[model samples]
Target: MAEFFNSISRRKFLLTAGASAGTVLLAGCLGNPPEDVGGNAAAPTTAQPVANISSEQAPETTAVKLGYVPIVEAAPLIIAKEKGFFAKYGMNDVELSKQASWGSARDNVEIGAAAGGIDGGQWQMPMAHLITEGVITKGNKPIPMYLLAQLITHGNGIAIADKWQGKGVDLKLSSALVSQVKADGKGGSRFKAAHTFPNVNQDFWMRYWLAAGGVDPDNDIDLLPVPSAQTVANMKTGTMDAFSTGDPWPYRIVKDKVGYMAALTADIWKNHPEEYLAIRADWVDKNPKATKAILKGIMEAQQWCDNFDNRQEMANILSQRQYFNIPVDILIDPLMGKYDMGNGRKIDDRTMAPLYWKDEKGSVSYPYKSHDLWFITESVRWGFLPQDYITNNAAKAKALIDKVNREDIWKEAATEAGIPAADIPTNTSRGVEEFFDGVKFDPEKPEEYLRSLKIKKANV
Candidate 1:
């Protein structure tokens, strides 16, 4: 038995904000985490004001509302707000709202298009790209979005129900398992494996995982969208047989004895880009100082989160009703580098942990253009973006990527935060990313990568 789960108590979600000028809480799933989870105990000392803007200078917009989903991946933003990083950079009144769903989260950004609703916070990087193209919008008015920082990498798992326990899906997916699953579905009902959203990292990675097991995600299994929080609950009710989502939820299923982690995404693709702090482009232009402050503060928070000592504290903060709202033990297990894979296999792996700053060069937070290119490629593969973007009109595609891939903002924030230059990537590309399948994504030759996939629209 995994001794860790025994120590945690089952709990319900509660939303309480601390009573202070800098801290405020709201009702339901996410208004703010408690004082500790909201901010660091000590604020970073090296947050230099942008353009000689002194510490006493006020933010361009004194009050800003940021939206985030209730998950551990949203930790950096919460930590920045809680730790006084927002206030430190002159954001006097920063409100962190826990969004109900991804579509709601995207709509809030569209609300920002009016110049007042939400300036920016953690969102799907693909949504950031698609929003710029008016793909998912309210008025077909494209909102240019910029990625300031990466929240976490490879911290999710694809969990399958207990019925499929020893069918060889844990850690590595099995073809036999896929065939069995497909055959088990009655009538015209499709075997479903829910991911958080379509045209996003979770969808792409989940597709790859399913495909690796010889399952055609589009045909053999219906890849549906389920809110992250509801994924485990639906799995419990057998609404979904499997789901690929951020940490704690996957672990939640295992704890309930309803599911087991079938494949660790980190093991499928190590140090891969996961989620990011994407600001609306116009917002970045108008509030350069405040924007830089947000990035710098969150960057420091990212480092704070990666530290081994802070895992339990992070779990505690997320456990409060205002955030993740799960038991502390379930939340902390993945953070502490332990995984109960639900198939009676336990593995201690750091690579599978939420990767933050891995030195300057290995920093997971840097908004690499190649990572965005991978997003575009995968998106286009699934017919999310135009096929021409991957072929004859690749430059137009590059330009679109350049518009959203804000490497400059990241480097500036790092320098202001006193993170050494060595930690920053000199170039936007992170070279070729090798996956467990022996395939490599050459940032320079993305077209080659797009052509290599066995089951993509590009290939078709």
Candidate 2:
């Protein structure tokens, strides 16, 4: 179990003025109990203002409403708001609303900030892409969105109910155990699994784990979308066999003894692309300066979050009543790359933990167009998208990725924020990515990668 911060007062979200004067305000509805302020007590220092943001770079608007699911992936956004990073870069009136579910975030983005919805905040893999093409939008009405930055990597895992403990349903399932699982799903009890929302990050993670173990996710299991909180409850009732999501829910399972994590996403794919920060395209187009300002704020926040020393404080801030609404203890281990998997397994490697800024391969905050291609290709593998999307008609897919992935803006923000040149990748692709199952995806030839897959819906 993780230790609690020395003195944490129960509190609710509050709005306050910015750190400096001159018409700037914090503008965020966040908790700020004096007891919860500051980073690690060992190295406490006053938060610094973002330098180099001249008057010319001031945002067109200081206020924007953004929605976020209360996963660790959204920490940068909350950190930016709580630590005054957003206000430091002229995003003074940014509102961080806790969304009920990923579905709610999707619906909110469609209506946008003008109406009672969000401009955008944290999103799962390929959500911004799908929303751009209107594949998962309301009535398929095509609500275009821009992919800004990847929020964090490796904070997620696939959790199996305690009933399956020691049943050989781990990172790699045995052939005999795979047959047993398939048989267990007979007579309409099909091994029901879930993700927060379907056809995206969580869903893909669950499906990949299953398929990699030779369990046909489509035919052998009943995979569906269930809200993260509800999935925990369902697991307790034995109604759900498994679920894939980010911390601190998975940590809650281990703490509450509801389930055991079969595999951390880190084990499946090291430093994989997780959730993202995106906004409505219209909002970005209307306020380009404001868009970059938000990016700069989040960029600084990501850098702050990557520091292990500040994770304790990060956990403390996120556990307030208005954020994740959980005990701070549940967050500490995962944030530090420690896991009590609730089975006989344990992981204490910091390198395998969630990373926000830099990782082994490079920048975790920069959105690579190649990563977008992988998500689209995975969608094709699972039949969420057609084969023509990436297999037969590759250029069409790249066109969509080019339009939606705003890496140029990320480069602009990096330069404006004084990010070192080596830190900013020169190419849109992160080169070829390899998975735990020996599957490799090369950005240059996505179709070949698709063809290498043995179990896929794509006609390649």
Candidate 3:
């Protein structure tokens, strides 16, 4: 009789516990996820199935962890989880870990998911290559990483503090601003600018824009790496002159009356390569099928994100506290390619929006090797990587790009996802790209491209 009583109590305990767990899950589905205080959040449990991957193509594993900074480029990853693309592709247990910053994302990728870090997610240009080469990793440990796909193109910009208004700070630096910078230098001060990470996409954008305006990035001003939130704060206090960062923050600057955008990356270089989706090399090798499944999920998500009709709902999902922690209003205008400029100059063009799957040039999702070459070549120009890294040793740089960029995997995943052959790119190169400054970069002859740049640090 006592044994029977104990069994009954155990059954009651489980029943009660199960009921409590259900309530919590329902709450999670009904509202924003619990605040991500510990650098990670619970897997989004609201799966509604956006695709139909067959059982035969089911992934080897249904679980993976990815890290992302709160920016527009991370939309595909977040949308895939929320809208059930991951679940449809048998990645039902995918976790979208919220990284505090790009540095945190890099560190998390190095440690991987097993050690309370991420397997990989979104990254800036050449970061995967640099990480693979041990140039940026902690202790210079070479962490092999694979560049899977470009997440989005042209959703970033440089913002200037409101104090610089009419002081001639725009896409091109005015002589007025230049003279002020020079005068400030005499007082042992310099115009201060910041990017989230050094020698990466944001840094390169800021530098390129400054250089194009005849402002030497390395010598004329004080450029430093700072987190997005801190940069915004500094802008408010009038201590920061300029900041190069992704959207939401830049838009927030205008919305909060702190600053105005100097130039959209789209204006600087139309259809430029932005952030990307990459994964740990070890994780991809161990679970090749799963890797492809994740890619298929992201591909579907990218297509969905590009649809203008879906952007309103996309803004809602991205604004959740667990993701960007921003208002939906700030995101919708940018997603629709409408900008107020905050300085009496407004732009409203769909072609200028952040593109995911396809754009005027071609497949925005395809990770072209040529794009990788351009990043490496730019690194050479800025002296971030050794000069011979690309100028004198083209073959060596190409070999590294070939090793890190996995466009073949993207093709295989696209095919398996039933994407049409017409949509798949035939060539690895995107051809010559022209900048707003009229400078062109040809992947075929990076040496000549480097030679044409008058403001570059590379001797070649």
Please report, in order, the local distance difference test score of every candidate based on alpha carbons.
0.70, 0.81, 0.81
Which candidate comes out best when scored by lDDT?
3
Per-residue lDDT of model 3, residues 282-324, tens digit only: 9999888899999988998999999999888788777766566
| Stretches of candidate 1 exceeding 4 Å from the true structure | 1-58, 113-116, 181-189, 359-361
Candidate 1 C-alpha lDDT tens digits along 1-460: 1122111101111111111212124321223334444332222223323333466444577666787776668888777665556666666566787765666567678878355457677776677887787776655558788877788887788888776767666666676766676675544556788777666777787888876666778767777776666665687787887887777778878888888887788778877888888888878898887787777767777888888887766666666555655567777778877898867778897667887666323878888888888888877777666677777636767888888888897887788768888788898888898887778888787788877777776653
lDDT of model 2, residue 223: 77
Worst 10 residues of 3 by lDDT: 16-25
Q: TM-score each candidate.
A: 0.85, 0.90, 0.89
**Candidate 1, poorest ten consecutive residues by summed lDDT:** 6-15
TM-score winner, 1 or 2: 2
Could you give candidate 2's per-residue lDDT for residues 235-323 as a string of tens digits? 89999988888887777787888899999999899989999999999999999999999999999999999999988888877766556
Stretches of model 2 off by over 4 angstroms after superposition? 1-52, 186-188
User: Backbone clashes per model, in order?
Assistant: 9, 0, 0
Candidate 3 error regions (>4 Å) = 1-47, 50-52, 186-188
